[model samples]
Target: MPNLGKLIVHERMRRGIGPEPFADACGISRQTLYRIETGECEPSLPSLRKIARVLHVSPGKLLDLGA
Candidate 1:
């Protein structure tokens, strides 16, 4: 499986976006984002879509990174 959290972190950081504002932009709590990023939880499809939208990448692109 793709390390979704790491992908998210990588993309966010690549864009020079910070955690707090990124979570805010995604409409999720920072704690929830943290959990997802830490692999403590998997994000739902909706959350994945939100994350992808923010990252300016397709959700499939993120998933494909692991393939």
Candidate 2:
């Protein structure tokens, strides 16, 4: 299993993107994004796509399932 939400936060920080603005760019509420980042909730595929798109990254980057 992938820790996708953690990966999202990690990558965002690695790229110097903050949680609040990143959440805004991803079209999610900051609280929801915080829950996801803190591993409280697993995002749906649609949510993942929105996040990935906003972050300018592939879903696999968020999933960390790439070979």
- Point to the candidate with the largest lDDT: 1
Best by TM-score: 1
TM-score on alpha carbons, each prediction = 0.90, 0.84
| Cα misplacement distance, residue 67 of candidate 1 (Å) | 10
**Candidate 2 lDDT over residue span 22-42, tens digit each:** 988888899999889888888
- Where model 2 places Cα greater than 4 Å from the true spot, the runs are none
Q: Local error of candidate 2 at 14, Å?
A: 1.5
In candidate 2 the C-alpha lDDT for residue 56 amounts to: 82
Candidate 1 Cα deviation (angstroms), residue 1: 3.2
Worst 10 residues of 1 by lDDT: 58-67
Q: Backbone clashes per model, in order?
A: 0, 0
RMSD of 1: 1.9
